[model samples]
Target chain A: MERTAFQIDARDNVATALTELAPGPVRLAGDGEAEQVEAVEPIPRGHKLAVKFIAEGADVVKYGVPIGVATADIMPGSWVHLHVMRSAYDERSAHLNLRTGAPEDTRYE
Target chain B: MSRKEIPSLEELRALRWRGYAREGGGIGVRNCVLVIYTVKCAEFVARGIVEGCQSPDVQLVGFDGCTDSQCAVNLLAGLIRHPNVGAVLAVGLGCEYVQPERLAEIAARAGKPARWLFIQNEGGTLPAVERGTAWARELLDELRNTPRVPMGLSDLTVGAECGGSDFTSGLAGNVAVGRFFDLLVDSGGTAIFEEIVEAVGLDWLLLSRAANDRARAELRHAYDKMIAYCRSVGQFSVSPGNFAGGLSTIEEKSMGAIAKSGSRPIQGVVKISVPPPEPGLWLLDSTPDPNPVQYGITNPNDSEGLMDLISCGAHVVLLVTGRGSVIGSPVAPCLKITGNAETFRRMSGDLDFDASPSLTGELRQDEVARLLAELIAETAAGKPTKAEALGHREFHIPYKYQEKEARRADCERR
Candidate 1:
């Protein structure tokens, strides 16, 4: 069965997977000529997968805007979430709790 | 998304509805008699009045602070002058800086039916509740005949704020809003988008969307101030849920968040409690004043953000949440739209519209926006939103420092 992912912009090097994507050819729901990309790993729903190769320190484009920069080299069909990318503006984003998304040192009084 | 389709000018301008007309200016989607307590001390009496009335037409909101802050005063004044408030009753405990008579004077000047009394002077709670209830009922009965006027898209001011965002929020929820904003702006309607703190790391992209040089400069100043404020506070408005929902950073969230403003050229930056000078697409910057002593409050929560939008004279407020939220503002009718289809289905009772059809490429962005516009029209025609039906008339008026000291000085000198 064909899986789907959305490339928000034609300039985007990544697409947000609409469902858990296994290693296979996935259809594109966004604007791109290739129409599809082969997923090499499992991509979680709402998480991103690179639609094109991204070199280290390169910007990760989405919504036609650079959301962050690649921490290391990334290839097409690979997961493009926090590990591969980090925000330039906010260094604390990397420290957020995986489950609750809570930031470090957050205490309720 | 090919080139994201947008609604034509005709579809936007086609909306026409009737609403109560405020004599001062603007149209009211709901005419509720608001009983406002000037300080925390008067809360019981004011709330008692609203409860005794047992009518939804009468509403209650109050300031819990004893100290004087221009931001709080202006926010209250904005609510009073709001087209939705048919009449206002100001209640105060004699010691507070915000006097009940003064609040009444402000409302009366705005051509609203106004009344005032101090909890101290009215022999405390017993007589106060009795007298305030009588006054509220009289105003409610009198306000029933408020003249209705034909209001169209051009005559409307719509504001949008996003909360509980996920990946779909940007791809669908906010995208729908952006397309609708374009439609609204093209038709000469005013669209105000707030949460300047969320516009992180995209200053150039933001400034480039300005309508002119003046607007560009304004956006720059506001953006810089917000960045400094965020750095000082050490928070970027991104939440844990946002992370769990697949958002990576403030930058990624900002990219999605700003999409609610659509592709329209922003008119300029507007401040809290200040309405848009004219209108096209104005950005509300509620960031606190950049002073050494006070960073001030921008958005404490989704409800405060919604109130900030409502204070700017919005007739209808759109709340786009990727993770479902059931919040509603007191003055303006909040139309809740979700971008996640599963969240929409699970929380169907609370959420109003779904933009998720665009997420699967099942529907065009412009088409979803037209359907959303119909809901706006129905809401303007007095159709209560799910929030309204649930009686979620939430409000927040936290004290914040603004550059209104000079204005306050002028008021004192008068």
Candidate 2:
């Protein structure tokens, strides 16, 4: 199988896109096993693609660690990014809300 | 990833490089003559003096603040007495809080040639530059004769930092550095990593690598302090560049950033500007102490972070950049590594090591690590890094509000 995305660790549900992937079937490989995942959208290089289905509020695993939680239900091959996920540690999400004039949250404090 | 074959411990101990032996039993890879400005007002005159001398060994460094902060003073003193420096020429405007004479005294106490000139007292810029140039030339001549010693890996204190990172940084560049750090620690050498803000979500991961219960608690405290400091400043470690480079959140960045520590048991955590007590993998808690209000956030720029590492007695800093950054430090040499093959190709002249092979699977992590160790040996033996050859000495000291001053400011505001 031609590798289109890279799963950094065996436990990672999100694999990094190795190249600019158009909407198509992408083969992800790691730890001696290969899996076929479809790209639901155009994914740029260095961006993450969901290799496993993640329910809303579930953790997005990468590097064998939980990076953050999904804000929306993310299906396999969907782009895993700020639009569907947010940082678990930083509650403010100030960067995302800057343009929307969203009220600042004190949850981080 | 599995560990690759490494040199035997006995063979590792045999690795040696010629370095300048400092008076205080320290080995320096580069014998630099530093022209330090006490305040920003004197920076121009200091640069003029260094330019007039026209010596690669003579470099410029300084603090930009006019008011005295003990932190600033301590950091400046450390750089002046750094092993890499053989002599120092301190320049001041005379009215600033930092005294040029005092800085020169630090160098003198270290048995290094030291001189001071106040721009105000020397009849302004031209005269100060003339005197400073002559003094720098003399210092350089004297430094040329500094005794060289054969130093082993155990004698080194290496610092690792990542800037302008992308996803490949963790998978390639930082991981390669982590492997190098593992070898360094295994060889009884000291290794340090900083930027606690980037370790926010990965505190537990770092804690798990602590050498003991005490080290674990210390790591936790550092992480807590970093979180509080960031919250106070209403900022996070993630930048627009970071997001564009494929990092979606601080947690993602933290996971990648912590990879530079490798899998070694962290001996302990030390405060900023304090060297590690023993040889092992250590973390430098660069967060400001006492939790001062109105104090700015940490890491104003990559150079400041590198400077902080240097203040902790790092002989050389391994800077991993996936998005590309061209920077260096005056007190410690910088070896820039890049994981992005395109970035390496575009900025090959500025970067030092290409760890892109790890990304392409052409070389295993440990193989790249071995290559990095060889590069470090070459650098310590006087091979100039790209930054050094190109003369990129970017230094900055961020403003830090003292705890007492912050308290007073709060009272006044109320």
Highest TM-score against the true fold, candidate: 1
The residue-by-residue lDDT of candidate 2 on B1-414, one tens digit each, is 234454554666688988999986688989999999989999999999999988789999898889877777878887877789899999999899999999989888988999998999999999999999999999999988999999988888999889989988988899999999999998889999988888978877888898998788778777876787787677787776677766777888898999999999998887656778899999987667643355666788888889888988899999999989999888788999988888999998999988977777778788788878877877888888999999998988877632311112232232
> Cα lDDT of all candidates, in order?
0.85, 0.83
lDDT by residue (tens digit), candidate 1, B1-414 = 233444455755776788899899888889999899989999999999999998877888878899877788888888888889989999999999987788898889999999999988889899999999999999999898999998888887899999989999988999899998988888788999988888998899888898898888788878877787787777788888888778877888998999999998888887777888796999988777655456355788888888878888898999999889998878788999999989999999999999988877678888899878777878988999998888888888888876522122221221
Best by lDDT: 1
Give, for candidate 1 chain B, the lowest lDDT window spanning 10 residues: B405-414
After superposing candidate 2, which stretches have Cα over 4 Å from the reference?
A1-3, A92-109, B1-13, B401-414
Give the per-residue lDDT of model 2 (tens digit) for A48-92.
999889999999999998999999999988888878888877765
Candidate 1 pairs with clashing backbones: A101-B240
Superposed model 1: Cα runs more than 4 Å off: A107-109, B1-12, B404-414
Best by DockQ: 1
Query: Candidate 2 - CAPRI tier?
Result: acceptable
> Against the true structure, what is model 2's DockQ?
0.39
